[model samples]
Target: MNPNPLKILVLFYSQHGSTLNLARQIARGIESVPGCEAVLRTVPKVSAVCEAVESSVPEQGAPYAEADDLKHCAALALGSPTRFGNMAAAMKYFIDGTIPQWLGAELSGKPATVFTSSSSLHGGQESTLLSMMLPLLHHGMIISGIPFSESALGHTQSGGTPYGASHVAGHEGRAALTDEENELAFAQGKRLAELAVKLAA
Candidate 1:
């Protein structure tokens, strides 16, 4: 085994903290595995009219992600709040800048998974998850999703899905995750970390 812990990047963008909650749970799952560590990262918001500028460091929450983070991670768990059935623009923007990593295959063959938070039960959660997977696929990542073995997927009324872990944040986008949602997110993270270890071996 490698003496240093494998770093699984928990990268996310949360407008109102719902997605961040999911990221935290996923990190817990990653850390549950021996020789694994979770690194949380977020992207800054963008402006529609003009270039949005902010400090290099975020005022709160996880530090803003950089290309180096992607290059060194052993695995990845992406999360975002749904935006009209797709990933939020901020997340996409960060992904768009990873051409160098893509060219060098920095993330190729790594284990990856995704998560999302939506405002409604049917508000495009699955679509958002799928959208996030596109860039990962281009980077040659191996995507993983929750399986039927996860009992929460069969009965989750709020967010769990076979596609990925998710949370229905409700119309106000302030709802807390149900017990099932939390379990599924944690399971997803743990699964990804385990896969990373196995693949590294």
Candidate 2:
């Protein structure tokens, strides 16, 4: 057994806390596995028109993610809210800065997955999940999805999908996760952490 617990990074950008809720559920699943731990980290908001520098530390929620987090994780579970059918710019900005890690192949051979929260039924949750996967693919991580066997994927009314776990935050952006969304998110994280452990062995 690993003397130190394996770290599964839960990195995300949440605007209205909906995405954060999903992250927590994922973390819960990761922790369910013996000798596995979840490291929840978040990216900061960026300016639309110009470059803005956030403080070294975030005011609330998880600590700001550093390149080292990406370098050291046994696996990763990325989450974000939809931004016009794509991941938010803050996440994009953080990912774009990982050129060093990409060049070093820091994430290669690692298992990974994604999740999202959208404001509407058709708010492009799947697309946003795909958007996050594109970079993980480039980094050579093995990405997985919440398969239909999870049962929730076939019947979820809020935001669960085969692409990944998700939540419909409603227009107000404060809606709680439906039962299936929560279940799928937890399942996704558990699957990712288990895969990581097997790969390491």
Candidate 3:
């Protein structure tokens, strides 16, 4: 194994864990690539009231993301639980705070991908994926997505899309990812990792 592996950031926000599940699978795919590592991070929740402040460390799951995380990552995978037809406000708020990276073009030429989880089958997974891509695009990242060649993309009954990998969490919003969803997510990450390694080299 290479002592210094390329770091692929898997950054996301999840309220009920479905998005987190996707992140885990993506990490698996990233690490499956030799000389690459998955660096998982997450953003804190947003509050309408101005007084709210999240602790420097998260209570559970991945560590909260920092500007330095962006600075060092070779590539990125952004995930969120869908809010209406967009990413969660917490994830949006975090992206908004990434002005330094955008200004410096720190993410330029890197391969990036997006993923999401939604409360229902029609709950805007594709739109959510697209929304996340906007910031990455502005940062000059090359967007990578799951293709029809992945097979799961062609036959998935629930929650896989060419735009990105996604999960249908049902109305109550906590369902596990179906087999197809998991497979596609894994493929998405693997594809992105391969691309990122090639680009970084």
Query: Each prediction's Cα lDDT score?
Result: 0.93, 0.90, 0.90
Candidate 3 per-residue lDDT over residues 42-144, each given as its tens digit: 9888886532665778877799898889999999999999889999998998999889888898999999999999878898888889989999999999999
**lDDT ranking from best candidate downward:** 1, 2, 3
TM-score, structure 2 vs. true:
0.95
Candidate 3, lDDT over the whole model: 0.90
Off by over 4 Å in 1: 1-3, 48-52
C-alpha lDDT of residue 51 in model 3: 24
Clashes of each: 0, 0, 0
Model 2, C-alpha of 136: deviation from truth (Å): 0.8
Task: Give one digit per residue, the lDDT tens place, for model 1 in 2-108.
Answer: 48999999999998889999999999999999999999999988876435557778888899998889999999999999999999998999899999999999999
Model 2 Cα lDDT, one tens digit per residue, 1-201: 658999999998898888998999999999999989999999988885434556778877799999899999999999989889999998999899999999999999999999988889999998899889999999999999988889888888888988888999887776578888889999999999999999989
**Per-residue lDDT of 164 in model 1:** 92
- Each model's TM-score? 0.96, 0.95, 0.96
TM-score ranking, high to low: 3, 1, 2
